[model samples]
Target chain A: MGGSEHDDGRNGKTPSAVVGDVDDFWAQALVDVPRETYVLRLYVVGNSPRSRGAIRNVRKLCDEHLAGRFDLEVHDLNQEPWLARDAQIVAAPTLVRERPLPVQRIIGSLSDIERVLVGLGVSPNPAVDP
Target chain B: MDTYESKTPVGETITKSTNVLQKVPTGIKGFDEITVGGLPRGRTTLVCGSAGAGKTLFALEFLVRGATEHGEPGVFIAFEETAVELTQSVASLGFDLDGLVASKKLAIDYVHVERSEILETGDYDLNGLFVRLEYAIASVGAKRVVIDSLETLFSALGNEGILRSEFRRLFRWLKDRGVTAIITGERGDGTLTRHGIEEYVSDCVILLEQRVHERFATRYLRVVKYRGTMHGTNEYPFLIHAGGISVVPVTSLGLTHIASDERMSTGVPRLDAMLGGKGIFRGSSVLISGTPGTGKSSLAAHAVQSACRRGERCLYFAFEESQGQFVRNMRSIGVDLKPWLDQGRLQFHASRPTLFGLEMHLANIHRLVEAFDPSVVVIDPVTNFEMVATNAEVRAMLMRLVDFLKSRGITAVFTSLTAGSGALEETDVGISSLMDTWLLVQFLEGSGERNRGLYVLKSRGMSHSNQVREFHLGSHGIDLLDVYVGPAGVLTGSARQTQEAKERADAIARQQEMDRKQRDLARKRAQIEAQILALRAEFEAEEQEVMAILEQDKRRELVLGRDREQMARLRQADPNKQQNGGGAG
Candidate 1:
């Protein structure tokens, strides 16, 4: 169901071959009805542009892909700076996936939707073209 | 930035506001002396070294010493090891990191960077690291900061461009905070650090090296670059022991020690008499070098015992023998050191030279000297140090040690064992030049025995003896006997004894010959006097007989004159005439 909106205007410049692969993978994912709940936390530094962009991009990815099956939380490191050390955060605007067994982290603004999908394990497309 | 600046109190700002570059003392022994002061204040220093080069320990000592000695709080941001692991690792060095943390004097933040779990998606800044560092610093009110290896970020984040920029900002930020910071990095090929951290932190850079020479490891530290101040460029040997890192700044010890005019005895009165009739100068370095079994240790022991007898504390460093062995051996030479030991006036520190590197031995000696505060220090068999270090290195070490002891006004006696058949004047350790008094002892093999011969090779500022004396280690202690100088040259041991005995016998024979001559002269004078007496008696008898004949003749003449009585008057006249005739005859 989310396969149609996978190629948003921001990702429109991606090579069509990779887009085709992502589209096919998402299409197969719709038939499988993936029910695994996704857990994510986004760490940011105040109201910086990268922070705002990461927050927006990560929320959009979770809603468009997992929808109500995912839970997301946002933390501003400026207000709770100690959380950076506690969460082992080095760079600003980081996303940590804490659910579905082995945890994973993605650093930087989550602008590349395909890479975010592949990183979150939502899309089965192994070839992540960024 | 404004908030951080405001958080720094006005008092701190005023204290740190100075035109001249300020330094914070590191409190490491001999390190601050060479650096003149410590690291540049409120600036980042790059410490780069290979693995096991004691980089971590050096940084840790800076923090611990800052907190404990200087009352300055610090933050340790460990990137390689966790805080707990670091605590355990440095515990061996007697650094209580956890206790320091609990006392609010230190703060440890372990920044775990795992490259596998994290994926790079887009643009990001290392503000998170900054935030954590700032939090730790603010929480402890720290004035010193240690980021043990900032290079780990390159491997973890894999973004050189961003990481490099971030490092530049972090260093500047640390400076703005007015906190002295140390950033450690792994050594790289042809560079000070693997990640070129030196390029960012240009205030100061220190390189630590651990080299294995002849199977012995010695750590060296050098200041490669210092921005605003003069620094020692030589590679100083450093030692990591229970007391942490101690850098032996050998050349930095300028020859500025005061030359003392006072003298202390060398325990042997005869030896002291040989050295200007008083002894070596107080605070002077005395080198007693001799061949093996030449009573070098015994001479050193004599000095120690004499020092102890004067109620002055003495420290003995034995490299070739244990405490009991040395004390017992000295006892055989009548130098009883046990009483001094029991009285706490003497201390013995014995260890094999191979147990530690030359620098470590020097550092240990330094520590013991400081702790004991002895008036005299004896290092028996200083030549053993050659096994662990080169001749030049041993010389340098001894030079520094001599300088240190002189500065403290402590008399130092160093006994060196000369190798077989080498020049007695030239010690293999090459430290003779550093000594103020040099006593050379050698084995004189003659008359089927090896006897010890000692002479003052050099005594600075004093007229020392030039004659080599027979050094005897008897049960009554060292007695220096004048070597027998005869037609056979300098003879010692049984040869000297035989020569002395022969001279004594010759002297007796000469006395006997003089006595025999006197007796013969007395007998001849008695015989001559008897002959004179007999001749005088014979003359008297002959005179009497002649007088009797003359009387008989005179009587006959008188009878004839009486017959012619009338001629008596004429006889009286004739007597007067005869008297005049006799007078003429």
Candidate 2:
């Protein structure tokens, strides 16, 4: 997560570090909280527009519905081809929900929030949406 | 050659013809001959065999031959053996792998596919192998490629679908690069290749079998399928030795060998008389079969003597006896082979047939015949070949050998030892059909004696005698005496002698009776003549006496007649008178 900064430039959906201590506190809070936490990984081909759009859409969906209860990781397929091979990644901009039991995958920019939420097993609350 | 050059279609037709799956010669001895050229070029050939069938060695030798002899570079992608181990294993075969590698004519890449090292997190293909193979090929500019065993790769990949698709891609890649590739595979149960690659590499599929028959192991190679080419269908025996692998094609030369019309003597004059008095035709194969101790070897020795006496080179392969022993034995029978052997006209090569594999024996024979260039080659008792090979195998070997010799105009004689006296119809090797002349010798046991009888069973293009002659292995040599024809049948040995004696005795009795009849006729004629003379004399004397008597008797008769008349008259008169007087008194 500390290496999440876009040092190689040309980054659109750059990850924002919001309080390292708070993330640690959330990390501890994850054990105490009775809520289930989700682990997600997003694969992309560098910082392309489609990759950035997919990243933005996934992050917004997780923040709006499952904030502080989800862990996200991003991988540039070009930089880690072996990882892509290991995951059998045929297409880029793939979001794979790893944890919370039954794993799932969603391809393309992840624009449809409801479909992305359904694919990731995240039930959106109307109150949280408001 | 001129016709082929003139009949050539120009341009696009040439392209079309070349595109018709040209064969790439594998350069292995007898292999190219079997395939007529070799496997389909620019295509994959699957070589499947069980363990110890020399599958890896075959693939390696293909690459090696291609690299060294054909001037075509090769790359060997070994899946089971490392490059060093492979090199070491083939060192004894006189292949300098390191030197080939150094000169860039051959490249060996060991693709170590360990199942333990592979973790299938997801579905994967063997792209790593492809990259390595491609690199190896490019490194050597190889036109020939070998993948020694795809089974290990399959085990490592552990996905049949992915492996199959990857194999298809790999084969296509090899073809796209125009490489004649050999893919070695472990034999599956009832399948050509363990990975079932035969379906993919259907262009050519070769199957190798290592069979242990009668405690002797022999390796045989067969082309299961060859597309767009005519290949020998019979299984051919192959040998792996210090000179590398040699595939002995069943009859590689075929019937194309030109036959000679020349003739040579069989040494035994009477035996020669049996074979149309000219022995067998030069370059023709002759088979001699008989029971043990029936002078088959002696006949062969006689043939050797005849061949050598003609100042022609002779090769005598004696399986049962050593050269020294054979020479000594033949000398005792008046076949002094020692002089010919010393003069270099006769070469005696003696060895036990069990000393090596059947193919190796054939190879040795081929090598020796080529080196010696013998005009006559005599194999004493082809039955010895039966000890190492099957009947079919021996026949095949002899067929090839006969073809080779006949092509070179070499007279070949084979003596076979039958199990007993009964198998006159076929030799133990069952190669009677290959012989141009077949001489059957057997024991003619009669009158409590065993005599050797020789007869010509068949003579393919000659008028040979069919009579069974008495084959005598005397102190002077083989003597074929005329068999005795009598009431019982054709008699030989003492029976023949007895029959002859009886015939002579009957002829002498007939001559004496003829002489006695002539003497009796002479004596009877004399006696008849004397009796006739006496009769005549008696007639003459009687006549004389009659004449005399006639003269005298005529006189007397006349006198008597006269007397009679007188007497009669007197008596008649006197008596009458007396009677009358007495009557009156």
What's the distance in Å from true for residue A100, model 1? 3.0
lDDT of 1 by residue, B515-568 (tens): 999999999999999999999999999999999999999999989866665554
Alpha-carbon DockQ of candidate 2? 0.02
Cα shift from native, residue B559, model 1 (Å): 13
Which is the leading candidate under lDDT? 1
- The global C-alpha lDDT for each of the candidates, from Candidate 1 onward, is 0.86, 0.78
Minimum summed lDDT over a 10-residue window in model 2 chain B is located at: B1-10
Candidate with maximal DockQ = 1
Residues B433-476 of candidate 2 have per-residue lDDT tens digits of 88888888888888898888888989988898978888888789
What's the C-alpha lDDT at position B324 in model 2? 94
CAPRI quality band, candidate 2: incorrect
Question: For residues A1-130, what per-residue lDDT tens digits would candidate 1 score against the true structure?
Answer: 1212222112122233345488876665565445556668788887877888898888778767766666677888779988988898888878888765468889999998888888878863334233
iRMSD per prediction, in order = 2.4, 15.2
Considering only N, C-alpha and C atoms within 3 Å, which residue pairs clash in candidate 2?
B381-B415, B549-B553, B550-B554, B552-B556, B553-B557, B556-B560, B557-B561, B559-B563, B560-B564, B563-B567
